[model samples]
Target: MPVQATSVRAPFDMPGILVPDFRHSRRFQITEFGARPGDKQSTSIAIARAIRAANAAGSGSVIVPAGIWLSGKIHLESNVNLHLARGAILRFSDDPQDYLPPVQTSWEGIECFNYSPLIYAFDCENVAITGPGRIEPVLDRWKIWSARPKLHMDALVALYDMAYRNVPVADRQMAIGQNNLRPHLIQFNRCRNVLVEDISIRGSPFWTLHPLLCRDVTIRRVSIQAHGHNNDGVDPEMSQNVLIEDCVFDQGDDAVSVKSGRDMDAWRLATPCRNVVVRNCRVLNGHQLMAVGSELSGGIENIWVDDCHFVGDGRGGDDHAVPINNLLYVKTNERRGGYVRNVHMSRVTATTLAGSVLAVETDVLYQWRTLLPTYVRRLTAIERLRVSDVHVQQAQSVAVIKGERDLPIQDVRLSRVRVERVSGTPTIVENARDVTLPAAVGRNGASALGADFKNSRRI
Candidate 1:
């Protein structure tokens, strides 16, 4: 019973992208289902009942009034909108058992059966979680899971082996072994016509908002402040025709990370993440404004980011300044066999950055280098990256490109990029072709790119 709401065309350059509109949906209040404030079990049961009722009614909104409601895992049904009223605070419990009966989910790009995300929607259509309120976690227990001990690494290796062996997804389960794999805060898996709007998310155990294998998704006017490990604000993986706009992110990882999937599993699916638009967002703290991969074995293309900027002194949870590392970072390795192309970024501004404006590395394996031997060696092809009108007050460098010798990165273009002060080299290039930048070096011996430079050369 998916909602037959108006499917408004997305306001982006991508074709065939539609956003769900649930303006006239009926309301099913949780209070009417015997939900009480501060009672986790009651609220959880009541929410389930309300969702069931709403789904049975064809299309409806399960509303939470202005109160602090403690809940467990809240699963959404098709056509059901989980709406939180203005003063509502929907707080989730951190007890891992609450997310029991492991659902089909992925951890860090590989598919496995893990603890359910705090809010999960699977194979549903026209689902949403809208709020002018707040959603946070009772993160006492989850905090302990954040530190990746040896057990966690062992579990990841196990999952990698499973994927490498092409094991059936249903047989690859990680929830049974006290694996301590942190569950995502919210995930929409294999769903379509998704909309998440006007929500303020405070903390997350893992990635905050994830759209996996979804279509026609719109995330608008969302604010996130999650400072835990791997707390990437939004991860669009294997998704198409996505729009992320009017958002604010202060996170421990990248603000907006576009991923496809990991190695063998992704190659099997053969789905690429494409046609994504990120605009009019502000980053307070993050590793990168947008990171294309480290897990992109399924390929990524047609990404456009514009009118986004870094703001607010880039502070972290300890009240100390946490410098944003880079504006655009694309990372892959010899083990990843995919293609990255047609990425365009423009009209971005920042006060200070800890790393370069553009960074592309082909040898970033992170902890996986020693965790396990390379099961397979396949090179990734990265090309056609364009950056323009980026003005940063101070940064370490302008560009850093490290590509493989045989298949180097190709067609990198930067124009109207102004850096007030640079602490290091203007550009460092190796194994790349067709890199175009401004001709004039800065007064401080640093390089600032502008429109006047048009020559392209291999490095």
Candidate 2:
């Protein structure tokens, strides 16, 4: 039977999120199904068999014992928990053929049929991946696949065109050719009451962990270290009532990126990503601590970030750290018609920042500008952003807001934010309204703002 774990309370005032608890569940060992260490094919087959056994027996855990086991794609079933014992290392196959037969997955923000994620769950309930083992991809093949040549760009163009025309999703397949749209490390698509806890994940082909269109997710005490291109630590896309806490993220991109769908597909779905809380997390290196959309056309609301910090020296050491950039970034373009509201951040600290503390840009389409013409001119409405009790030792700038003339960003407030030193201008504003940076929040506890800026021009 599927379990609906009770909602867990959050420190904030929002609704509690549900998480699966599988304490007394029956355990099905993979070794019993003839799994052998270091054999990818056998281990993969054994894992599938064990999952079937566990699911058929009501609810149970499919246990992977301590060893170096190699496997292919793992498709989670309903009412099943895939647990790994201590000292267990599950390495995934590097060959592309292991992920054949395209699955319903998304790339960036566009939905299409692509290679299955290394671990995937579609339309399942009460699923969890727990325990203190390591799950990683072999980077040998993925490192080369990361580069997007003309073939990949052409595939992206086709995907965008399909979305624009409202083509059936079943017909849009990109896994047939050398498109090279890499799959995510783990994806739980349309699954409810999901829990991912105590696992260490390293080396991703794309975005590391994604919870898409799911409800009531709890990700706790996990560690991620993936420096590959587009390797965001966690992306909660079009999901609701999520709580991510007590995690350590050393990422190539943002630590937590909250996104909705993109453009036309988003408009059709009209499901906003809302009610997400990220707390008590640490970032070693990333583009930003948190980023909200260049893909937010379905709208986003009610996000809270609390007690997060950036650690590690900016100098790239033997660990190949990339250094932290901005504390928070909200990016969008004219082609996306969405709204971002009620975003709050508090108790954040950083040793050094390569960019501004907060940045909002209205024009942030990387390659889409020239690749495709804007079929529709739609703007994103961003408002009601608050930051408080943030202290940074050094930064390039305090804040930067660049909004379009027609639809400017509004109602941004900063309080008790102290930066010891800045290399560039303390604040830069363009086409924004009601930006209140109080005199109390500044460099060395001095006034950085002379007065409240309303409908300000570029400075």
Root-mean-square deviation per candidate: 2.9, 2.2
Instruction: Please state the error at residue 35 of candidate 1 in Å.
Output: 0.6
Each candidate structure's TM-score, on Cα atoms with residue i matched to residue i, is: 0.95, 0.96
Top lDDT prediction, candidate number:
1
C-alpha local distance difference test of each model: 0.88, 0.87
* Regions more than 4 Å wrong, model 2: 1-13, 315-319, 440-447, 450-454, 457-459
Candidate 1 ranges with C-alpha deviation above 4 Å = 1-13, 317-321, 441-443, 448-456
Tens-digit lDDT track for model 1 on 1-459? Answer: 433333333223576655556677789999999999999999999999999998888888899999899999999999889998999999999988999899999998999999999999999888899989899898888888888789989999999999999999999989976689989999999999899999899999999999999988989999999888898999999999888999999988899999999999999889999889998999989899999998899999999899999885767655633579899999999998999999999999998889988999899999999999887999999999999899888888888888898788899988888887778877777788888875543456444443212223452
lDDT of 2 by residue, 107-134 (tens): 8888899999999999988899999999
Q: Kindly give the stretch of ten consecutive residues in candidate 2 with the minimal lDDT sum.
A: 450-459
Candidate topping TM-score: 2
